[model samples]
Target chain A: MITLSNLISRIPGGIAQGIIWGIMALGIYITFRVLKESDLTVDGSFATGGAAAVMMITSGISPWIAVICSFLIGILVGCVTGLIHTKMKIPAILSGILVQFGLYSVNLHIMGMVANVSCNPSKNNVFITMRSIPKAILVGIIFAAVLIAIMYWYFGTEQGCAIRATGNNERMAKAQGINVNNMKVIGFALGNGLVALAGALMAQYQGFSDVNMGRGAIVIGLAAIIIGEVLSEIIFPKGCQFFTRLIFVIIGGIVYYLIMIVVLWLRVDSNDLKLATAVIVMLSLAIPNLKKGE
Target chain B: MLRIENIKKTFNPRTINEKIALNGVDLVLNDGEFVTVIGSNGAGKSTLLNAIAGVWLVDEGKIFIDDVDVTKLPEDKRAKYIGRVFQDPMMGTAADMWIEENLALAHRRGLKRSLRQGISNSERETFKLLLKEFDLGLEDRLSTKVGLLSGGQRQALTLIMATLQRPKLLLLDEHTAALDPKTAAKVLDVTEKIVRKSQLTTFMVTHNMKDAIIHGDRLLMLNNGKIILDIKGEEKKKLTVESLLEKFEQASGEEFSNDAAILG
Candidate 1:
């Protein structure tokens, strides 16, 4: 029988995981919603960030510096995808796929040809750890809050407005003298950079990084975004500001994890978790269309 | 202030569907001139505007705006001097953006975009006043999305956007073609007021012969990628739909085949 103690013990861990995924969701929001471009590169870039962070920390680098480097490396990865899409004239989805495939090898190289790496929280000055779940949750929340503030400020700037316009209407953006191609590249770089930042934090929190850790990251990010949007519609019936919408995206991530905890608590087979995630995402996406029909 | 020299463009080159859109077309417009363009289907009117706007590089020849060679510039780079409204009302403004945001974007045309705030208090005031002048009650809806506006309102807003920064040349490619007759007429009225008030060098392509003659200081008829008739001044003012049809027949040695042009 599932007990109250079992549920209580899982809550902190769930909150930490949700906050980390919430950061990833914000990254996906930039590409999927703001740029209106499908980018699958996050799956590979997430692992790359984890590998970079773990390897750097193991090599005696500061954890904060290692995380920052992981973010920069992610931006470079995103730039490769952007160039493939914009300069090489490949479709956005195909370009992201190509980069994702290439980054699997690059990520392995970053981990010194290893598929996984682990850092001891005591040996390394790690940023966060599952040993202290409450501390990890607090750290994740702070990181998310800071990132959201930066993003809110960036999107209100002139350059950010240009990027928004490029996504909304390419023809109108070009007519307005906004370089649409450049905007796409900048967006990709920013999106992947944030995804990498989240990956770094996840690795530090879990005290391990693995190549397969980010296999279905894009789905999780989408789940967060869609859930956040749906919830925001209910919570703010009249309307809300852009910053509020972003905050909801983070909340969506938290809610996703809470649901996952509940499902696990129900004694569902752990091996079938991926299938459960897929069903949840599919339903979340279809609900809006289905509601419109009614 | 605008010149097109022997520009040529072909669609689906080397394929069975290959069609030459602009064939060695040449034209020039002095500063402050208002030129209306009329042509039948496949007459290269839209192609001419696209070439001048640098939608793509011309296969041959050069384009100049205000004596600056812009034939090699990409569309966004060429936007420094060119303002355009497309055949579709939806093509002009970002639908999801607020009305004031759209105006702010237009206000920054050809100017450098930085980390500065996208819209300032002063600029918002200016946009509010400009929307008030439209008399479409859009002034109160500055924060509303452009997608929620009516077709006529969108076109009028587009006209205002094209002239927000006083472009060196304005290219209107049947901007009101998609609107209903009444809405189209209202948009045309706004177009004329903006063009006349700014004396913007304009090239307007229209399917309506009456509109072609009723507005603008000069009118040109394009046929088979060539300018077959050019009328201006008192001659253009006195010209009617019948006389324009007669001129097309006289110049091209073919019947004026576009019923929309004649009936409109």
Candidate 2:
């Protein structure tokens, strides 16, 4: 059933999916690389974004407005996680997990208590749709480019640098009169906002949203980031510009999806996709440490 | 410039590892007065500095920095009036940031961070001039990540950063203890230069007896969470290691036993 030409035809779809997930990985990069906190909120917020966007689109709201709403909602979710950690003194990891656990019900409520929602692309002119691969890829590229530009500019500002410092060294940040708690809260918000935006785009592309759409999303995001970082190191051993790194993260996402396409072409069971991803990520993460040992 | 009234802190209170780090300690400092603290391992010299820096809330006491009660202020809030360098050089600056970026962070200490460029062109020039004065060659490496710098260089940079905003009080917690003697002396020289230039109120804790005797306008000896001895002015000026050791033994009613304090 699997053939080289068949695999080749599926490549564009994989690339489109990769770009969407790449945006999600950018969100993860904020907390994982910048704040140095692993937030599990993306798993839930991602689905929430899809749910919100699909519900809005079906309710006659424009796709752009729907995507923006999803981003704001994700930020609100992140703020809850942040406040729970900073104010309630819960550990960062636990706070993110708690909010994520609670978001399941919230996402269902947003989807009118349904487990899944869909927008008929035939009637609605979605910003991105898989019906036309070229259009979908073009829209994804534009979104990625604009988001990357904003991130590059924002992280160069005074407040942005403070956030970076907070992640780098909390004690030093506080010593420099930075409100580290506030910076962490801001990081979580911005990170999840981007994650939700990616979710909205994915929903539009797929024409449907499901409650479980974001299962294992964090691992996938990490895979993209790790792949991107490793590749970037190989391509630019001395390190590259921040803007270039951002672009590489998107490329990493595409590469990950392309690998999945290859695995599919090899006739691996679809249910084993998650297993393969875990192995790939584990190996990607281990390669650097292994090389260092040698 | 600084006042402490009956400040106390107990680590792991009521637990098997309970330690009274500070107990009913009180002190006052005039503006521009530099104070050096000396103590044995458990004498709470660093704890006293931490109390003033508001690293944690005191158990029962009021602290006044320039006559403003700040006993309840959190660490970051207190940072507006305080500058600190830790024993670890890495603690004072973000390692991943560029040399100039770290300076920019320090330059904006106690000021509201806005959407403005983190480091302006004029600010970069000012930083370059300042770094040039230190002669660390860091002036030429403004864009280099601070992690690439040597420990001594990092400490020197930290010293400059602490004084960048002209903090009301400077706290140096064994800042040079981890460096080699050569580097330690270099950092100490930088410290003295900055303190004398700005006349900033300063508190320095050191294990080296000679350093304690050589620096500061006044000296404090902490023993078992208490200030057992306080010497200043002409008395501090005339103090030698031998005489200071005798004074410590007399006040604490115990033999001076910390090897590093004696040998360092």
Candidate 3:
């Protein structure tokens, strides 16, 4: 029932949103793939970033400064989770949940006890807005490119290698004199910082920050990562380099949005989108295990 | 140079599962002395090694490396002077990492990891040479993931990694016990070569009685959470599997009954 023009019109907006989610997915990849942890902090930290950025911008702060502040706040949030998991000896998943539960109040306070904050692009010079979809897409692509570059460079360094090794094998890392707990803390901080950065940008792009914006952010991030990994395996059968894997993660996000657009065109109820996403992610996650059976 | 004075460790104390892992253990090792440790199941052999490696704080006692008291230090802090290889071949190396990357990690052991590039071009050359010495065709596969390696190759790589930074003390917790006989012998040969080459003060725990008698300058037998026998110098050189069994009976006042220890 959807015309070709309708589908074409949705591409730019979908791409823009996909790019933002791709950045969020990169954060998840750092924790899920690099650090080998299932961190639930992103769900809360994403909203925290949106709250921080919207509040700071509404108070006459530069958008760039607001983004940085959001990232720093996210790092603190991640540190709290890491400390709970490491010092308190709680399991990583439980620590993440505890921090996420606590962050709801913190996010509400940051938004001045409100569930939502709006940034009117007409009244203020916002960095990116849905009004100009093409510009938003360009800005999103640039951010993704810059972030992937920084991550690639950082992971090639010795401290970065230590983090990777700690994620791969904690016992071996400790034996090699690498402080595994410190590495975990650092990794969590960095991952959440990036997620917060994405949330900040996303608030500007969408013209509003809502506490519920991050409710299912973790699932979307995982979906992006899984899509990226599967796509990379199919496209690059020779295996990918570190940087290439990251590039594919962003590409995966874009593809995920495209798929969603197609599903929407088929007249699926918008309210059931989350259910569809969950099923997609579940199938993607089980693909490797299914292959092993063969 | 390592010393353990009156160390004690008890697991699940005051519970039905209470077990004494180490009971007032006392030991001293001169610099560069290779000591082989042997014991039956539940005899505190691995416990002694774990205590020395600072896996956890001893319930009571003092530990020192080169006269530097390290009793209160955590495992990572003590790692500066200690190198260890575990019984599981998969425990000593990160399976997802490339062989060179794993080596690079070991190369920086005890050194602060900074923003410097990992595995420089010159360092890669050194690693290639080192891998070539193993002659297992690993030099050609420096970028290969360690998970792809066989158990013996992993054990050999672990041995190399343990000695890369030349720790003050090396602990091998049944490092070769997981491999087949042929692979075990090859790995042991490499272990001896590296140990002698670096002159590392080493503590090796093994179930094989013959291996205990054949290697190391000194031998120790643990029984019931205590060292029941300690032998060294000319006396250790003359020991055989039968004599070690006899010595275990004499020291512990019980027959050597562990089948794995006897037959391995």
Candidate 4:
């Protein structure tokens, strides 16, 4: 118990979890921070990604191909979110919740089971594939670095600036020849695509895809964003430049689990994990607004 | 260079709040022409610019730029031809990004955005030279976040961003209305210098009658949703606030009631 090797092993798991959820954090960052769209579909779309990856891999697809499929599925899910917002004329937040509720069952069907999809049978249903925890951590880090680099480059372009413009001042962005509608659609697609890729990697690493995995993801991502925002405000308060937003979000994700690790170290039970997470996010969100008021 | 024919827009269409913003308005701007629009509140001055910018679909109209029927084009697709500055200084550039980065973005308008680490050395030098023209000491501070600049500096930077591409049509929708009068005048001066130096076709909307008359070769007055008066040539040169008001009543058959527009 609490040996150096055991701590190292758990470090890999915690970091892997942080990186996988970084995708969701990036998704929340786009909706809440960037485009200012509150997308609750994040939870549903994230599970859908895992289910899609599992379904594809189970159907004789290569592991890498399943990853691609997972990303595309995420894009489709995002498009549905947009369709609900635009064509159906539904409120954005409501549309997200509706889609999430639908995906709860759909994810079960994708796994060809009502509970979980596993690479091997176990009583507790924990599966261990060749994608070991250490390898998963490496994959997560490399994937995050590449994705953030691409994000940095993309947001530096005109279209990227246009997307940001939509959030800063929608009317002005439209008047300056930026289509806010199309930009929102693109932003959603990109945001969820990252989330799905994370899910694919997660399913492979854990050797199982379960429906409940995505639960409370949005809150975690929001907490990370709020924490990241607070950090960036204190560290680089002038602004979180294009690349810096993504960088800080990644750091936010890492710091989030480190806080979780500390909570677990304090012997907090599993039942209160969600409660602790909620409090942390609430505090992060509140402190900034309170400071502004003061 | 720009033509708007029979354009009409209704806000909250098919509802109780359906307010007609532009009622079959028509206007033409020759190449390299500088035109100013002045109107009362709800006069559709901004609506006309918005229609051309493709912010939304017009209920009825044809918009042409350099003889191209641009009404069917999307906003970003039309970015190649149009440059716009807005009343809010934040509208024109990404505030968190550096001044050079914003300029680099403006410079790459209508081009494919690639992953090749934006802003080559040559472009950086070019941006510096362009920034120098603003004389706002921005050339030395290209690394500064745009949000740190004063409103006037931001507006000035915004003007440069709009004109950097030598756009076929430049639209200014009360670009300086949000600033103090002194800063507004400074920004207006920067606007004038840029517009003239580039020799681009430009349409500027302003609430101040004096600014409208003093800045452009032509001034058009709007009331309700129609153009009440169009002055150009020798007649436009002779306009004063009083005489312009007299013409508004003559053309529109009503007294101008926009106190802010009149007093401004």
Candidate 5:
């Protein structure tokens, strides 16, 4: 179990998992970090992406292409939330909830005739059973790498800095000639795109896309980001240095999955996993506030 | 270059806690004019600048920048025309970003922001030259985050940023009030240099009556809701604190009781 080859084999898998969660953490980072906007759209948009991917793939599109479509659709869902917040003057939190609820029905309807689109391993189109694991890992790495590069470059730009300034102080952003609304819209769109990419990748990795796949995903993603921030604060007391926060996001995801694995290892009773995950997320949320107050 | 005619604003309208912040306040600024405003704590000094900057929709009157109607323009929309520095240093620039990045945002005024990296080599050179003129040693620290800067340095940087785009009207609302006397004087000098060099139309509000009278070519005193005294030209040249105080009492018929305003 502890052999060199075995450890090497696990590296690819661990990296893939970390990157998969990185996508979701990235989505959370945009709303939480850049715009300082709390958004629940990730919960629904993630499922919306998975559902859309499954429906399209089953309807004869390649699974690979389906993933791209899901990402684009995720951006659209983010736009809807932005529209509601900007045009209706609805609070960001409420707008996210409204979108999440609406997407519940929308996600189910995307399944065509079934309640869920089960990926039959026997009837594989794009990937074989033996190659599926490596393929998923490869895809996850590529997606995470490309998206991470894009984010790194984007946030370094003037507009990207404006988005960050808006998060820091909207009034100051306006005083500097930055259109805060446009920055928020861009952040929203980018956040959802990453979430949908996560959803699409998840569908391919698990060989299924359920209507409720994205339930509580927002909290989980947030949990990863929070854990990462906590870890990072300890390592670098001066806060994020360049892409260190993104690294924490990846680390947070691995910590998240490892905790789940430990729970399973300890023989947690059936249906208790959800409760445990919720407790973990709640702790992550509360811990940062407590630290800040201290 | 900047004019306000009968501008009015009331906070919490039609309510028990209602307040008439600005009551038909009117003022004018000529091209390359430097004017300072002094008022009591709640004497509509800030409200006047806020109105000019389109911070809130006015209840009445009009604001014009070189004869363009801008009373209804939102705060962000007017950023191209007005550059404002606030009392709080943190309120002017993004502390999380590097000084150069914040400068880039200011330098890119009226330019479209895309996903590509901004701050070209030429712009960086320009920023270095500009910051060097401030003599704050900020030229070598372009990558340094603004949060690391002292309060004085931050305010100075904000001053440079406000004047970067050569705005039609530069609004300095107590830009140096938070600084110590020494740092405040230095910032005031930098401010004067920028305004003089840019030939910018400037409206600066200050609580220190002496600063108002000393730096700017003209000084206006505000009381309840209007300019109580406007002193400039030869009369301004010969004017002193005692004479200005005498004029305030003559115009308002009320003794200026603000000790901080007089003492400063």
Candidate 6:
């Protein structure tokens, strides 16, 4: 049951899924690292994206347009969270949770009150699907590369630097005439937009979208980011370029998925994957603190 | 030029921890006037500066910078006309960003941020020339993170950032208070140089009496949410720590026995 070939065959699937999740991790990086806010809206926006994409694809819409729509929808969701946090004077974490909670009902509505929606590849002309794993991997890599390049260029812009400064130090940003609240709203919108894009890709790749597909997505994204940071430290002891950092985030996702494949191959209970993810995240987070202790 | 009229701010109104930070305070700063503010712990020196900076809305008052009322504007909006260097060097600049990037942000103050490159070659050259004036070897380390810089260097950089755009008004809130004596003097020296060079209207709050007297053209002493003494011109030049303490005691009707603490 635990044959090497069985595990080997799953590697491509693992890589494909990892790359999609890697895109999601990039979203998390914007909020968690750049904006310094742990936005929980991604968990729900992910499902919202999948559900929207599946429903559109099933109804004869172009899959590409469907994905783009999902991205825009995700941005609306993030704007709601941002407004709630800033204008309403609520805590950032609570605001994200509120949006995520509300998104469940909205996601269900998008899927026509159904828990799952599917677009059969045989009928629907989906752009990326599990039917051709190799093609999916190739497209995923291209998407990652293009996205990374855009991010590198965008973050080096004047408005982008303002967002970074807002995250780095709010008082300084404000004193420098940079609007801190507007920057935060923009950050949240951009972050969740990427998450929804990733969710749409995952939906198409698997040929189905489930309302619960985004459950525990934040932990996975965090896991990828932390793992990537560790790898970057090891490879470039001093520092690495921003582009390489982005690439390693995808590599980190790949490594995380490969490890999961091995765990599944070893006959670990499939239902225990969430527990495994928690362990991985907790260990990754604790390692730096433990090192500091020594 | 800056104007304040009957601005009053009270913290924790109706609560036991209530504090009357500023009470009906009014003052006008002329163009290129360098004013130093001094007080005890709760004399509302910072509260007054924050009011001018629009940190929070005053309960009752008006603030104007260059004849434009800014009492209703928030901190960021008012920042277009004002440059502030906080007591903590860390509060004035982003630590994770590079030295040049910090200067770039300061240079673009009051301007719209667009899709253009954050730091242009010409802007970088200007930043280098500015940093070189600090004589802290920061010009060569333009790419280095501000966090790695010493306290004095960071404070000096903050001063440069505050004056980069020649703001209508400059607010320095105990900016050099956290540095050592030599470093504090150095930063103050630089501050004097910049203010004089640009003729920028400036307000500096300091706990050290000597710095207050030595650096600015005018000095105001606050006590019990009021400006009890305003000394300037030849009289300010003739004042000393001992005489200033006497003035504080005469104005507030209280003994300032711990003059040494105030001198610091």
- On residues A1-294, what C-alpha lDDT tens digit does candidate 1 reach at each position? 798899988988998999999999899999999999989999999998899999999889999999899899889888998999999999999999999988889888888888989988888989788889988988988998899999999988899999999999999999999999999999999999999989999999889899878899999999999989889999999878999999998999999999999989989987898898999899988887898996
lDDT string, candidate 6, A1-294, tens digits = 789999899999999999999999998899998999999999999999999999999999999999999999988888898899989999899999999999999999999999988878999979899889999999999989988998899889999999999999999999999999999998999999999999999999999999999999999999999889999999899988778988988888888888889989999998999998999899988988999996
Assess chain B of each prediction and give its TM-score: 0.98, 0.99, 0.98, 0.98, 0.97, 0.97
- Positional deviation of B241 in candidate 3, in angstroms? 1.1
lDDT of 5 at B164: 86
DockQ of candidate 6, scored on C-alphas against the true complex (2 decimals) = 0.90
Which model is ahead, 5 or 6, in terms of DockQ? 6
Q: Compared with the true structure, what per-residue lDDT tens digits does model 6 show for residues B1-264? A: 788999999999999999999988989999999999998878889999998998899999899888999999999999899999999989999999999999999998988889999999999898888778768788899999999999999999998998899899999999988999999889988998899999999999988888888888999988878898999999999999889989998899986544534657
lDDT of candidate 5 over A15-73, digit per residue (tens): 55656776788888999877888999998998888888877776778877887899899
Each candidate: RMSD to true structure? 1.3, 1.2, 1.3, 3.6, 2.8, 1.3
Candidate 2, residues A209-235, lDDT tens digits: the string is: 999898888999999999999899999
Q: Across residues B167-232, which tens digit of lDDT does each residue of candidate 1 receive?
A: 999999999889999999989988988898888999999999999999999999999888999999
User: Candidate 2 — which pairs collide?
Assistant: none
**Which stretches of candidate 6 lie above 4 Å from their native place?**
A290-294, B257-261
- Backbone collisions counted per model: 0, 0, 0, 0, 0, 0
lDDT of 4 at A104: 88
Per-residue lDDT, model 1, residue A30, is: 95
Model 1 chain A weakest lDDT span, ten residues long? A119-128
Which pairs, if any, clash in model 6?
none
Q: What TM-score quantifies how close candidate 4 is to the native fold? A: 0.87
- The deviation in Å at residue B157 for candidate 3 is 1.0
> Whole-model Cα lDDT per candidate?
0.92, 0.93, 0.91, 0.80, 0.83, 0.91
Predicted structure with the largest lDDT when compared to the true one? 2
Stretches > 4 Å off in candidate 4: A1-12, A55-62, A86-89, A121-136, A157-162, A229-248, B12-18, B111-118
Residue pairs that clash (backbone atoms under 3 angstroms), model 5: none
Q: Give the higher-DockQ candidate: 3 or 5.
A: 3
- Model 4 chain B: weakest 10-residue lDDT segment is B110-119
Residue B124 lDDT, candidate 5, scale 0-100: 87
